[model samples]
Target: MNVLSHADSALSLLPPVVAILLAIFTRRVLLSLGVGILLGALLLTQFSLGDTSLFLVDTVKGLVWDDGALNSWNLQILGFLVMLGMITALITVSGASRAFAEWAKNRIRNKRDAKLMTVFLGCVVFIDDYFNSLVVGSISKPITDRYYISRAKLAYLLDSTAAPICVISPVSSWGAYIIALIGGILTAHGFTESGHLSVFVQMIPMNFYAIFAMLLLLCVAIWGLDVGPMRQHELKAQKGELFDESKGLPPGANADLPEADTGKIIGLFLPILALIAATLYFMISSGADVLAADGNAFSVLGAFENTEVSQSLFYGSIVGFIVTLGLAFAQKLSMELIIKGITAGARSMLPAIYILLFAWSIAGVIGQLETGKYMASLVTGAIPFALLPAVLFILAGITAFSTGTSWGTFGIMLPIAADMAMGSDSTMMLPMLSAVLAGAVFGDHCSPISDTTILSSTGASCHHIDHVITQLPYALIVALISIVGYVVLGYTASVMAGFMACCAVFAVSVVGLKYYAR
Candidate 1:
């Protein structure tokens, strides 16, 4: 029955939750993760209070020193930090971020344009969602704040806009990953075509939750529907008090450097170009699009699947960062000056990395327990045929929200969705799988505990809980509309219909709420 794994892993996350609560309440993300990790280890080991001396050693070894433990993901995450350091350094040394911000301010006259700019900025930095959060948060916080937007609201806008924007974008890190996963599904489904083109075309139209969530956020940004924590933010803005920043900048960051750097323009563009090139190359090398049902991974350059793309994009981002940093050094930028900018980026990410590490560890434990598979199996066994798609979407959404990871949730649910699809008509299967993935993202966007959500807050220098409180109401409102969209899509087996309905419903909801709530 795997009872020990289930008992230990399934419940191990509880202590971590308490730790996060303590961290938020105490204003310490790192300390929270440390305490949480220790507590999680204790739960896994069933250590008594008196046995802590030995338990401490073992837990440290297992968590930080073990081959697949914290240290490893720490290393992987370090690569990202280094990359972030280089890129942000490049931006500062050259002046691109400021220039972009200035251009945005000069042109963007309203909230809709601001939100659209955020989306466009997110699209422009697609190698990593983590990077996107930092750039967007650093740049947008000031702009949004000037317009009387709350830090929490800004954080929500940044967080919700980061990953999903990449996921849907044709040329981002997420694009490659989704492509890889879909490719495998396509092959298994006996498709004559390859590289996920078939599934991507079918599923993109059915990603209702993604479509509606963005629409709702954009609507709120423009028309202004203040409810839940948003209303509180509005009231605070009226009083001229906003976020609790440690400095004139966001909390826990340095603004000693001048706000404008003349050289930063070239610095910013270099690393971004490198990051993109590296990503495309990395995807090609992975087992992605190389094979055309004939056993090779590269029948064409454009054929790789999603996981392959994900791995490459992660690695590519690092490679791009190094080259970009080297360019700055070549241009006679002082090493000290460049290093300072790098440190700024890394310091900002410290909280996010801690949360990601714990989230990864939790994912490891849950994976050991096969939690998603079990849940999927349970749902599959209990539900009737007609209700499968809707039920699966709901289940996937809940799990992602609880765990604070849409990708992990999808990794689990995708296979189940594929299995269900393989058993049914291909027409019925593709859109349904997309719906589950979309819903998982919806839930992850709203989850207070999600790392992406947390990073977005950290990036925007907003109070974490404040971000959660404000964002949840908006996410839920969109999700409520999405439910109807998905059900109709499921029944009619029409991806286009579901997606358009989603847009229409969200538009109506945003207008009604803004008008009536007053």
Candidate 2:
């Protein structure tokens, strides 16, 4: 049956709103999501008890087994997660992480250097946010812990850099997804003069939230600008209390495996390098297949534009896992121990997997109800042209924050923003589009229900709620600067001037908070 046929207007928004409110108040993510799903199903069935029951059944079926059997994109994602878990487990069990941490301990020297190293590593893995967060968190946690850096801070660094970096990096999976979305909308509207890639390139500078977030991360790393709950966490960390033991920690908290007598850094470096290389290879090859199917000539950018990123990630993880397994065997690790490590690692990720399923289901339900279209209708004709970018930014942020999915927000907002821009001065289109992207990232960064947030905590072995609480202030600071930047750009139509103003504001805010905000 067609799910998108139903459009419930403002009522369509209740599911996500209920989900977010319940999560914040109750701090029970799974229960909140379950209630939200039931509410959505009831709404979808128009409160018919029999249909609602069937809808819930179908929802579980769809999430667990694509349509009927366990297959499709959901399965691919699950496979990737399992492989990643195994790889992380193997690295830790083999003492590769400890080996690398020991090697870096001599050189890193201080807490600031350790934090900066985490940021550097996060930025380097721009291929995918999931990969970035998990890998960086696992690799850096040992070193950060050694330097008495809080797990909350490490989580913040992991999260802030993951989505923000991917969104801005031209060659990333996020960039490819965005270009395709823009291209589809523009193609349908018969507006293809500059091409989607060219437009996306132009919009890069206008991605103020991402630019500002990376800048703030740098400042936090270099100058030790900690404020809000983060500052308290840092203070506690300085007293050798990295995390409150009274509060429950997520799985993989003690990820630093016992050191092997002959452990080498090669165990850690090889799998990571393999994962990156394999993912790139798979992305290009997968894209090439799509291009050939469409009878188009081969080109790196063109192929990437058509690549199946999820599938590529799945394949890459598999390769990485195999390489790690080989290394474990080569090191003469017992088969039983290797299997145990893999199981342990995969078990740690089970919570994240369940959360993802619920998040995806809610997103699907929201799409079915046309919540995005309904929200878009509210703002499409109400705003003045000059303030459109800022309005869209806020709307996108709210949508993403409520739904906990940036891609869903993009799917809902980008077309509407593009159509609105078509009627106004053409110069504003790029900025408005940029605003949607920036706002989505901002919201995702802040939302506790966001998958990246969950993964970041899992990676750092921090309490999930603690990570959410500590990271919110930092995300808000950048968001505030981005909103002001968009407002100024709306009037001046000069990206450079607006960017400089935002940077200055950020710098001043940092200095003020550093000296006076205690």
Candidate 3:
């Protein structure tokens, strides 16, 4: 069971991706992560040094100590830390976060409305998961408490919509990431004759997971057909469930969220605006000069050629932090209070900071082992030629589910799709590549291990595991339909047919589930 035999599977496409996935859903994230890391390390050690145990120890020690792949990921983790600090400082200084909560409490006439409103708010603020979680959870907690909505239900709604909307919306953080990745895939696949197209014309339509996630959210909102962990939580909420966990005091926790702090929210707004403007500028420039890799907007965040998504957030967040201070000074709020707020926000992000490091460390190890290429190769080798597209969807799902990382899977699969397009008929390339993107996103969206899941839980003040459990079934059902859509499209090579089929499934599933479950 602990064997790392697939060490030299020469798999870059399909098979090993599933291995990563299997390790992920084995339930305990830390345990699953350790298992995957150990497995890969052992196999690598065996392949290179002929000592499995030595490899395991070295990988761990290297990760904890050495200046290698792990170091690069740490660099990214630092960005996450900075971004969080900025978010906290901005929220507290402006008082807008607290104002939003107060405003929500004042608006609520009853508990049910409060709970429903929480869900409504989660949808309205659809730009970033961090903002959504911090603002929505902070504002909704007291409101949900008043209405008897349990912590779990609040988290469920928060987690459900947080990344779901971003993935679909053209203007949000998800859009920037996906578009950039799509540009690369297009370039590799020769979607454009010369270089990677910065603007993805067709890929957006094929992003099935994000699309179906939105549909799933719509269904949950309209039908309220809660089931499994979610339904159990809903009942507990109805019964006035309560738990006193004393989850640490993050800075944002100090203020009621989404409140109209003319200063704080405004502070928050300036940086966000800066980020959006920056992203648009970068994307446009990249699109204009498709052949230039350096032209990609993501690559030029704070310093030149720094496309790290977190850096963009960090730069904008720095602006936000400054705005918070400026606004506080203008309001005559003591420097002491501003410092206190920043400290609190950083504290709240401590867990995220740690998780980011660990996730990166693991990814670092996987990268060293060429895990993506290995898995992609394995899957491609084993896949029946006729079922390559179907397998792509499945592998993408498995990869996302295992790593709680749709982005990581996207990085892996997009290249594979490009490579695949070269070997196959040009017509077959786009549809299959689109399926890969969609499936990877679908898997990550619902995974408990997903960062998105964590954000959702924090946003709704829901228990971390509870959010994962509640949202899983719905994600699976949609995944099933996505698989079906890919299959239909695989045979016909028709995006429209696949799109229509998915819509049809959503319609029937919603109606049938509502009728039958009722």
> Of the candidates numbered 2 and 3, which has the greater lDDT value?
2
Candidate 1 per-residue lDDT, tens place, 359-476, comes to: 6555554454455555565565655565666677788877776567777887778877878877776667777687677778876876655777777776676766677767877778
The numbered model that scores best in TM-score is 2
Model 3 C-alpha lDDT per residue in residues 1-518, reported as the tens digit of each score = 13343435553222234334553455334545555555555555554545766666665566446654454434543554555555554555556545544655667777557656766877777656655665567556656766666666666667666766666555555655666676666655556663322244455676566677766776675567777777777776676554324534322233332333354335544544554455345434434344355453333211212234444444545554565566667766666666666666666666555554445545555565555555566575655454667788888776676555777887888777767756765676766777777777667766655666666665554555556667778888888778777777777778788788888888888887688557
Per-residue alpha-carbon lDDT of candidate 2 for residues 15-89, written as tens digits (9 for 90 to 100): 888987887777778888888888888888888888888877887788767745675677777788778878888
Clashing pairs in 2: none
> Which of 1 and 2 is the better model by lDDT?
2
TM-score attained by model 2: 0.94
Best by lDDT: 2
Better of 1 and 3 by lDDT: 1
lDDT ranking, best first: 2, 1, 3
Off by over 4 Å in 3: 1-43, 46-98, 105-190, 193-199, 239-308, 326-340, 381-386, 418-424, 515-518
RMSD of each: 4.7, 2.2, 6.0
> How does each model score on lDDT?
0.64, 0.83, 0.60
